[model samples]
Target: MKHKSLAIPYVGWMALFVVAPLILVVVYAFTTREGGFTLDNFSNMVQYAGVFGRSFLLAFLATLVCILLGYPLALLLAREQSRLRGMAMLLIMLPMWMNFLLRTYSWVFLLERNGFFNTLLETVGLPKLDIIGTPAAVVLGMVYNFLPFMVLPIFSVIEKIDPRVIEAAQDLGANSAQVFRRVIFPLSLPGVLSGVTMVFIPSVSTFVISRLLGGGMNLLLGDLIEMQFLGSAYNPHLGSAISLVMMVIVLVSMGLMNRFGEGEGEAVLL
Candidate 1:
């Protein structure tokens, strides 16, 4: 009872910071220009559906990229023992130690017209690709930043798996590919869902990646929200509406993952 009482302050802090902000968003989503509660904010989201659609598409692609890059890295890390896994974790997380903006700006430095990547292509007599200020750059930034998030959860799931399960399958005449297909892959679904969720929500809401890396275009809902909040439009109500739409999408996505992605053997890969 005493320990529970001591933990009340921590719980209160969580409510103040996390719960309060979320409640505010929900409340503001229903607020009107006349400062009355209404569904107009949500209705206003119809005007910006194009932007939200594009943002979800971008986030989905970015999460896919993270899965492609992170899954193998996670598998490699999972194969390692205690000390080696710790070292690999540190290496994977080293980039995250830097500020997110700084890391994103580093991509700007690398993807600029005359950046090192282009310079190297020039030296090799290859055509320099234009990537910055495009959706590609936004995807790059999202993948780079969220890859660690993808890896950690998948690695956790992969590492927790019993090695004997795979060995048992092999003894039953299963090959490496079969062992993975029937055994290891299913066990890793929870982690995959977790990684995708982690990557998608932030990538969808990140104006910075689009602004700094995507060269400030009409490629995402985040940019639209920023314009609504800070630009000439300056309708907090509409911005809140758009934010609420995003929140719904995120919630639905998470719910789907939770419902279908809880068990490894339950993944229905079409």
Candidate 2:
């Protein structure tokens, strides 16, 4: 009875915030301003398919980059001694301690035409790179912001692995490459999947990064949805429709990750 009672507050919180908001989104998505049922909002979403595609593409690239960079770094961190590991983890998390918006905006100054990198290039007589207000900038921003999400989960998984397993593999005549390929890589799938989900979902749905870094030239699914509700359009119904579609995509992605990660155990999101 006590345990059951303890869940009451959490259930109530979910009902009030999560469930209620979802229900409202559904209602807004499927109903007309006059309160009549309709499907026009969803049907209209097809017109913005290109924006959705671009969002997914950018997110995919960013997640791939993070994995490529983070996997090796996670391995190094996982193998570090306790004190060194703690310091490395702190450095990885340092950027996250700042306001998300502030961190994103800082990139603007670094990548702008007259920004630090460009100035350095000019000083060195190298051609200046025009990266700000471009898709490359959006991808860079996403990777910078979300790379830790990829590293931490994989690091946690790798660190938790029993050292005995590696010794056993070596005793059985397995080489370093074979041990990693057959054991470490397979065992780490859950963490990799979790990191992919963590990075991909937010990257796909981000509007602020695209808006600020891409100078509004890159229109993602998130930007489209925001425009419907908060931009000149002011159409909540369409916005809700887009939100529902995004939710479906995210759920599908999570389902795929869960399927692949089965038998490896659940991945720690943090």
Candidate 3:
């Protein structure tokens, strides 16, 4: 009875801090100016359908890039001895402890018109390419920020995998590629799914990275939501509607991953 009594206040605190804001957003999504509940906000989301697709595409591209870049990096680090592996992991994690906004702004300094990349090209007598104000820049920023997400998950899985499994395959006359294809790759699927989940959600909602890297009028759903809340529009309901849609998309992806991951299709992505 005492234990249950002690838990009551903590439950109340969770309700106040966590559940309350979610309830408010749900209320905003359903509420209408007429003081009645309606799906008008959701209907407005359908009216702006193209924006949703653009956001989804940008996020997909960013996730793909992170997987491509981070998987090999994780593998390389995992191949090292324990001390070196610890150092490499620290190098990846150290940047995350810094302010995210500061890191985003640093990209602005690195990719702006007169920034280091452009200046380097000029110095090399090569044509200066414009990265800022482009979707490519958005992908670069997203990959840079989210690469750690992919690396860490895969690294954890790799570390747990017994090296003897690979050795056994090799002893049985399986070559490097064959051993990896039959054993290592299958074992690493959980890590890949975890990495995908980590990268996808953040890439979709991250606003500052896209804004700083993708200067000018390149649109992203997160920026649109921010504009709705803070700019002249000031429509909380619309922002909530977009937020709900993004949440649904992410949830659906997770559902699909789970179904495929544990099923016969496990051989494919797992």
Candidate 4:
């Protein structure tokens, strides 16, 4: 009874904040300024379909890059001794201690035409690379900001894996590659799925990173939605519609990832 009573505040909080806001968004998404029900907001999304496509593509690329880069790093960290492992995890998490916006804005200084890397190349008499205000910059920003999300989850999962299991696989004639391919990789699927969900959801809906890194040249669905509500367009209804769609897409993607992860987990158990 005490535990059940303690849940009352949390339930009230969710109802007041999360549920209420979602309900408001849904209401606004399906209504006009004149308070009449309509489907025009969804119909208008067709014109911005390209933006949505690009957003998802960039997000997918970022998630893939994170997996490729972070998995190896996570494996290395997970293999380290306790003290060394703690230090490595600290280094991975250090960047996150700073404000998220500030961390992202730092990339602006690094990737801009006259930024640090370009200046270094100039001093070295090498041709300066132009990546700012491009899709590449957006992907870079996403990866840089979100890589830790991938690394941490994978590292946690890998660290929890029983060492006896690996030893047993090796005793059964499994080589390092076979052990990883047949055991470690399969066991880490949950972490990979979690990392993907963490990175992809934010990347797909990010406006600040795209705007700051891409210099407004690469507009995403987030940018489009922001424009409707806060930019010169000022169409809250349309913004709500886009937000609702984004929410649905994220929910569906997460469901797919969960299902896929479960199937892989079951296969590995078998």
Candidate 5:
């Protein structure tokens, strides 16, 4: 009874904040400004297919880049016995301590035409980069901001693996590569799945990164949604519809990832 009473505040908070907002969003999504029920909001979504495609494509690219960069770093960190590992992790997390907008705004200064990156390249007698206001820039921003989310989960899972299990594999004459491929990698699927989810969701729905880095040329789904609610459009109904669709798609994607993870686990066991 004590536990139940203690849980009541949290439950009430969820009901008031989460559930209530979701319900309101659903109601708004399915109705017109005057409260007439309509499906036009969903029907109108077909016109924004390009935005949806571009958002998902950029997000996928960002997630892939994060995986490539973060996995190796995480593997190294997990295996490190020196104090340098702590320092490295701190460095990785340092940028995250600052405001998210501030971090992204700093990239704008670095990636712009006359920005620090190009100026440095010019000083070195190399051709200046013109990647800002492009999809590439957006992907770079996503990777920079979200790479930690990928690294931490994988590192946590890998660090927790039983040392004896690895020793047993070695005792069976397994080479380092064989142990990693057959044992460590399979066991790390949960972390990979978690990392992928963490990176992908935020990347897909990001507006600030796209806005600042893409310089308003590349409109993503998040940009569209934001425009509807807060920009000149002023259409919360349409925004809610878009949000609902995005939520559904995200849920489906997460479900598929979970299934894939389960299958991978089973296959490794077999």
Candidate 6:
């Protein structure tokens, strides 16, 4: 009874903040401005298919890049001594301590035409690169902000792997490559799933990064949703419908990833 009582506040909090908002969003999504039920809001989504496609594509690329970069770093960090690992983690987390808006805004100055990056290149007698206002810039911003999310999960998982398991694999005449391929990689799937979910969802839904770095040229689903509610679009019903669709897609993607992780774990056991 005490434990149940202790959970009352948390349950109430979730019900008020999370459940209530979701219910409101659903109501708004399925109704017109005059409070009449309608499916036209969802039907209107066809016009913004490009926005959805671009958001998913850029997010996929960013997630892929994070995996390529973060996995190796995580592996290295997991093998390092505690002292070095602590310092490395501090450096990795240092940028996160600052305001997120400020961190993202700082990149605008760095990537703008004739900004720090191009000026540095010019000084080095290299051709100036046009990165800002482009998809590349948006992707770069996503990777920079979300790479830590990818690294930390995998590192935590790899660090927790029992050393004795690796030793047993070696004793069975497994080479370093074989052990990693058969043992380490399979065990780390959960972390990779976690990292992918963390990075992909935010990357797909990020308006600030796309707005600031993309210079208004690269519109994502988040930007579109924002425009609907706050910009000239001014349609909360449409925004809610878009949000609902995006939420459904994200849930489906997460479900597929979870299934894949479970299948991989089973394969390893077999």
The best candidate by lDDT is 6
lDDT scores in order: 0.84, 0.91, 0.81, 0.90, 0.91, 0.92
Score residue 184 of candidate 6 by CA lDDT.
Answer: 94
Per-residue CA lDDT of model 2 for 63-86, tens digit only, reads: 999999999999889888779888
Steric collisions counted per model: 1, 0, 1, 0, 0, 0
Q: What is model 3's C-alpha RMSD?
A: 3.3
Instruction: Evaluate model 6: give its TM-score.
Output: 0.96
In model 5, which runs have C-alpha deviations exceeding 4 angstroms?
263-270
Residue pairs with colliding backbones in model 1 are 186-264
Q: Pairs clashing in candidate 3?
A: 189-270
How much is 252 displaced in model 6, in angstroms? 0.5
**Model 5 residue 101 CA deviation in Å:** 0.1
- Candidate 1 C-alpha lDDT tens digits along 1-270: 657888989999999998998788777778877879798777656777788787988999999999999999898889877798888888998998999999999999999999979999999999997998998888989999989989998998898999999999999999999988999888888788878878988899898899998887745888887888897678877777787777777887777777776454232221
Give the lowest summed-lDDT range of ten residues in model 1. 261-270
Cα RMSD for candidate 1? 3.4
Name model 4 segments beyond 4 Å from true: 263-270
Compute each candidate's TM-score over C-alphas: 0.90, 0.96, 0.90, 0.95, 0.96, 0.96
Native-structure RMSD, model 4: 2.9
Model 4: per-residue lDDT, tens digit, 1-270?
A: 758989999999999999999999999999999999999999988988889899999999999999999999999998887798888888988999999899999999988899999999999999998999999999999999999989988888998999999999999999999999999998888878778878888899999999999999899989988998889799999999999999898787777767777665332211
Instruction: Provide the lowest-lDDT 10-residue window in model 6.
Output: 261-270
lDDT per residue (tens digit) for residues 1-67 in model 6: 6578889899999999999999999999999999999999999899999999999999999999999
Q: Identify the runs in model 1 with alpha carbons over 4 angstroms from their true place.
A: 81-87, 262-270
Q: Which stretches of candidate 6 lie over 4 Å from their true place?
A: 263-270
Which of the two candidates, 1 or 2, achieves a greater TM-score against the reference?
2
